[model samples]
Target: MRHWRRIAVTLLPLLFALLHVSGVLHLQVLERLESIIYDTRLRATMPGTMDTRITIVDIDERSLERIGQWPWGRDRMARFATELLDRQQVAVLGFDVVFAEPDGSSGLASLQRLAQGPLAASPGFSEQLARLTPELDYDARFAQALQGRPVVLGYYFTSDRDGQARGVLPTPALSRDRLRGKPLRATSWQGHGSNIEVLAKAAPAAGFFNSITDSDGVVRSLPLLAEYQGQYYESLALAMLRVATGYSDLSPLYDAFSEFDHDVLSGVILAKGQSRLLLPVDPNLATLIPYRGPGDVSGGSYRYISASDVLEGRLPEASLKGQLVLVGSTAPGLVDLRVTPVGRTYPGVEAHANLLSAFLDGANVLQPNFAPDFDVLQLVVTGLLLALSLPLLTAGRAVLLSAGVLAGLVGLNLWLYQVQGLVMPLATVLVMALSAFTLNMVYGYFVESRTKRELAALFGTYVPPELVEEMLKEPERYSMDAANQELTVMFCDMRGFTALSEHMEPLQLQAMLNGVFSRLTHIIRSRRQGTIDKYMGDCVMAFWGAPVATPGHAELAVAAALEMTQAVALLNEEHHRQGLPQIGVGIGLNTGTMCVGDMGSDIRRSYTVIGDAVNLGSRLEGLSKTYGVTMVVSDTTRALAPGFIWQELDRVRVKGKAQAVTIYTPVGTEAEPLAPERQQRLATWQQLLAAYRAQEWDACTLLLRNLHAAEPGNILYSLYAGRVEALRVLPFQPDWDGATQFDTK
Candidate 1:
C-alpha cells in the first residue's frame, strides 16, 4: 500500500504537467502568475535607479493651441531642423513623423491652372519654367535645407496579401542566401504607403521607426532589420546607425542566430576593420527598448532644447558637440503616444531614450535561447526522480529530497540572473515542486481514506463522518505545541448569561447563544487579527500576535474589545423587546509576552494561550465585577493603547500574586486633563491619599469631607472617601504592605 501510494504521488504531478502541456488544462492562470512575477521584478529593479536617458521634445496642447493643428509643412520642419542643428547643436535627428508627400505650399498647381489659360501667358510661363524648373518646385527649398546633413528617411513595410514592393532599396550587404534563407523578422504592419519621395530626398540615413506591440497593446520591441525578397533592409533606427557609422558593408552572421545554453543571443555585428560591435536583437530582430521618460525638471543628465528655441538660436553649440541626439515631436496633436510597463500615455520618443540608456548603461536583457530546452530537461529530471526516489524512501526522506531539488533549481536560476544577466523563470521549477508535493499528498489521502474507520469513529462526535475521513487524509493547519511570543489577549463574558438561560428552554437557549457567537466568530475570523480560542459558554477568548506576529496587536486587541462592547449593547436592545433577557459583556484586554498555539494532546487538540499575562487578563475580567466597569485593562495594556481614553483604577494584587499590577477602567476621556474643577478635585484626592498613607487621620478625614462635598456623585471619589475612613481605625503596623488583594475571582 505504501509503495503504491508513493508511486501515485509521483504520477500526480506528471499527469498535471501532461494536462498542461497538452492544452487540456487552462494555462492562463500560470501566465497570470508570470505577469505578477514580472511586475514584482520590475518594481525591485526600478528603485534608486533610472535606466533610460530619453526625453520628450513635447508638442504639448499649448503648442498645438498656440501654433495650429499638426502636419506642419516641410519648410517649417526644415526650419525646425536648422534650429536644432545650428542653435541647440543636437547630435542626430530621427523623425517619428514621415514626410511622404511633396510640399503643396508653392503655387505650382495654380501655375499649371494659369498655364491652360491665355495662349500668350502659357507660352511665357513655359519659357520661364524651362529656365528655372528646379527652383519652381515647392519641395525644392526643403530638399535644399536637408542636403548633406544628418537626416534619415522613414518608411513602413507590410505583409498584406495584396501588398507589393513599389520602390528600390539600398544595396544589400547581407543577402537571403548568406542568412541561409532566414527572412528578416519584421513586424507585420499593414499600411497604405509612405512618403518615400520626399523622405528619401530629405534624409541620408533613417530607420523604419515602427514598433511591434504585443497582444496587450504594449510596444516592447522594434525590428532592426527586415527582409524584402532576397534583400536585407534596415529599420529606421538601424539606418540612422549605419549613416552615423558610415558603414555600408553590413553582413548577417548565421551562427549568431543560435541559442547559447538556454538563452537567445541574436545580435548585429557592425563591421569595423577587424573588430565588430554586437547590437542585441529581439525575437522579431528588434531592439528591446530601455526607456527613460522626461522626469528631469532641470535637464537631468541630458539637455533638451526646443525646436522653436533652436530656430531662435537660444541654445549653446557646445552642448550638442559629439552627442547622439534624437529629434521627435512631443506635440500632443502630433499623436506620438505609446504604452509601456511602468507608464501609460507616454511619448514614443521615450522608447528611443530607453534604448539609448540601456546601451549606455549596459542594462540590456539578454534573450534566453536555451529556455525551452532547459524547461524540458527540468520536467524530465524532476518527473523521473519523484517517480523512482519517492517509492524507495520514507515520507520524511522524500520530503527532504524534494526540498533539495527545489532549492537547487532556485539557486541555479538566481545564479544565472546574477552572474550572466539571464532571467530564467524560477516559478517553472516551483511548479515542479508543487506538482511533486501535491502528488505525494493526494496518494497518501487516497490510500489512508480507505482504512481509516477507527480514526473516523474517534472524530465523529465533534465533526461529521465525511470531515473525519478528510481529516485522516489531510490534517488541517493545526498542531499541539506551545510557542511563546508577544500577544494581545481578549476575554469577553456576558453579564446576564445565567439569568437568560434560566428563563429559556434548552432549544431557545442554544439558539440565542448560537446567534450571538456566530456573529462574533465571523468578525474575529474576518479581521484575521485573532482567533476565537473557543467559547467558554458565554465568554470569548481572543488573542493577537500569535500564529502570525501582528506588530500592532495591542491596538487591534483594544479596537476589537471596543467593537464587541458596542455590538453587545445593540444586541441587548434587540433582545429587550422580545422578552429575552438583556445581555452585556465585560471585556478585559492585556497585551504582553505570552505562549500561544495548540496545547492539548494529539487525539484531542485545542488552540489556546498559557502564560502569566493571560492569567492576569482573566483575573482583570473578574475584577470588572468589583469596579462596576464594563471594560477593564492592565497597566501593560494601557501603556500600549495610547490612542484610547483610560481612567486609572486602584492597583490590586489579584489572588496568587505578590506584585500589584495596576488595573484601569476606561471611563473615556477628559477634554481638559487640567480643567480648574478637575484639577482641584484631583489635588484634594491626592492630598487625602497622602494623609491616609502617612497615618494622619485628622488630615485625611478633612480632605475626604471636602472632596465629597465638591463631587458627591463621583463613584471613585466616594469609594476612596469610604476607604480612608476604614483605614483610619486600623492600628499602624511596621509591615503594612501597599498590595491590595482581591478576595473573589
Candidate 2:
C-alpha cells in the first residue's frame, strides 16, 4: 500500500501525457516542439543534390529590373511563353502565378471607350479600330500562346470576403457527385483567385498554388488537392506531375476501413493507360515539401533561368531544351518568397519545383495515418518504464537510465523517418517521460515532511529515532513489521585512516576519527535527512525512503553522499594547513527493493536493511577508488535522480552478480553547463565509445588518439583505449555486449 502511493505519484505524469496524446487535453508546447523537430530531421536527411529535370523561370530581381517590374505587359508574357515553348522546346511548362484581371496594357480599352462615345459617329473610326483590334489585344495574344499547349496555369483559393469569387476556376479534379456524400479532410475554401476566362479556356489544365502555412508560420507543406464549391482541385505541382507523366485520370483513394475512418481519404491515385501513381496526403490533403536543399535561385536545388533572359532569348541556344520549367517570381517586391524548413526567404516557386521533383521521384515524406496510436503507445511504454523503475533507483542512476531511454527513443524516431518516411509524434512522449521522472523525484522530496514533526513531539530523547520512525500511525501505512520496501542504501568508507592511526597516538587517533565521524554523520542526518544504520570501524552505512517514508530517498542519499565528499575535501585542506596526513573518502549508492527492520540477536539488535541491493552498494563504494571518483552509483540509483550531469563510468559484472550493471560518476548539477573544451572532449569520448562497442576498431582507434592528445592525463580514456587495441586484433566474438566482467569486488 505504501509503495502504491509512490507508484501512483510516478504515474501521474504519464497519465497527463496520455491525455494530451488522446486529444482530451491540448499541449501547444508539444505541438510546437514536434514541428521544430520535424523541420530539423527533414533538413538533415534531405538530398541536397540539384535536380536538372525541373527548372524555375525565375522572375528574379534581375529579371524584374531588366523587364521593368512584375505584371510586365501581357505582350511580353506572350513572348515569354512563346520563347520557352516554341524557341527553347521545353518538355512541360507550369505557371506559379495568376492572371485574374484583364491586361489593359495595350490601350485597347481606351480606344474602345472612345469608339463607344465621342468617336461613335466619326467617319471610318470604328472601321479603323476593328482593323487594328487583333494586334492591339494583348490578353488575346497571351491566351493564344497558351492555347492547346501542354501548359498548366496557377491560381489561389480564398476563404475570405463571404466566398466572393473572381474569374473562372479550373476543372475540378474530383467532382461533387464523385464524392457521393462521403467526407474528406481536405483543405476547403469558399472563394478563389483564378485565371481570367480567356486564359483558363486556353490552358488545357490549371491548378491552385496556395501554400499551407503551419501554426509556426512556416510553409512546410502545400495541399496537393483542395476542396472548393463542393469539388476538389489539384495543386499546380500535382497538375504539372500529371501533365509530365501524361496521366489523364485522378481519383480519391478511400481507406478500406471506412467505418472507423469516417469516410476520410487515405490518398489520391492518378492513372492513365497502364501507368499509375499513388500520392499520400494528410487529413488536410497536404503533403510535406521534400525540399532538396535551400530555396532561392542560388539554393542549388534546381536550375533557375531569369524571366527576362527567357523573354529576350539571351542564352545559349537550346540551353533549356528538354527541361520542365515552372514560371514564377522570386523578386522580393513580388512577394513570392516563403519561410520554409530550408530557408527563410525561400522562393515560393522552388517549393513547387521541389514538390514536382518529389512527385516525379516518388519520394514523399508523410505523417503515418496511425501516428496517433503510435504516439500513445510510445508514451505509455516509456512512461511505465520510468515510473516502475525510478522509485527503486538513486538520483544519479535515474538520470542515466532516463537519458538512455531518451536516446533510444530519438534513435528509433530518426530511423523510421529516414528509412520508412514516417513522421510520428515525438515530443509528447518525450515530454511525458521527462515530466514523469521529474515529478517522481519531486514527490519523494516533499512527502513525509510532517512525519518528522510528529515523531519529535511523541518521543523527544527517550526512544531511538528509528523506533519512532515506524509508528504504525493510524490511517497511514507506515509500520515496524518486517516487510519489503523500495529503498536507497549508501556506503561511505574513509581512506588513509589506517595509516593515520599508526602514526598518531591512540588518544589523538580516537579524537580525530570521532570528529570526522561526527561531521560525516551530520551531513547524512541533519543536512540531507538520511537515517544512519551503524558505524563499522572507519565507515558509515545509511539508508533513505525507510520508516519515515521519504519518497525521494535516493536523491536525498545521493545529495548526502556528495556533501560528505566535499566535507572530506575540506578536512584534507585543514590537514594540509596543520601538516597532518590528508584523508580521502569514497561513497557508493544503490536503490532497490530491500527488507528493512529491527533484525539482530537478542543481545544486540539493530534496525538495518538486508538484501542484495545493500550488498551491491558496498561493492560500488569500493569501485570509487578504481574510477578515481568521489562517488560511484549503480545504474538504478543513477536513473532515479534527475537534473544532475553524470559521466558514465562502466558496465561491469561484479563478483557474485551475474547481471552486468552500468555505473556512473556524478559530475555536478545541470545548472552549470560544461565548458566548451570539456564538452568537445566529452563528445569525442562518446563517439569513440560508440565505435568501440560497434567493433569499428579503425575509427575507434583514431578517436582514442585524439582523446589521448587532448586529455593525456585521463586514466579512464587510457583504460578504454587499451581495451580498444586488444579487441582490434581479436577474432570476431558474436556474444560480446560491450560489458566488462570483474572477478573482484
Measured by lDDT, the strongest candidate is 2
Over 4 Å off in model 1, which ranges?
1-4, 18-26, 47-56, 116-138, 159-161, 164-173, 181-192, 245-248, 255-265, 292-306, 330-333, 360-362, 381-415, 442-745
TM-score of candidate 2 to 2 decimals: 0.61
Per-residue alpha-carbon lDDT of candidate 2 for residues 1-745, written as tens digits (9 for 90 to 100): 5445567777887888888888898989888999988899888888889998988988888887788967888899999898888888888899999998999988999999999999999969999999999889999999999998889999999999688899898888888777848757788899998888999999959989999998898999999888886788999999988888888898888765454434667689999988788998876788888899987767788988888888788977778888889999888888988999889988999999998998988888788577888998898899889888987788899889999999999999999887777788888888887888888778666764454464455443323464465443421344345689999999999999988988899999999999999999888876777778899999999998766778888888888887888889899998889888989998999999999876778686666899989889999999888777789999888888876777888788888899999999877777888888888887787787677778899998899889889878777777887888788889878787788887887
Q: Write the per-residue lDDT of candidate 1 for residues 50-114, one digit (tens) a residue.
A: 43333334445554555556666666666766765556454566666566666666667566666
Q: What's the lDDT for candidate 2?
A: 0.84
RMSD of each: 26.2, 24.4
Which of the numbered candidates is closest to the native, going by highest TM-score?
A: 2
Off by over 4 Å in 2: 121-123, 256-262, 394-396, 442-745
Q: Give the TM-score of candidate 1.
A: 0.52
Listed per model in order, the count of residue pairs whose N, CA or C atoms clash below 3 Å is 26, 12
Cα RMSD for candidate 1? 26.2
Which window of ten consecutive residues has the lowest lDDT sum in model 2? 471-480
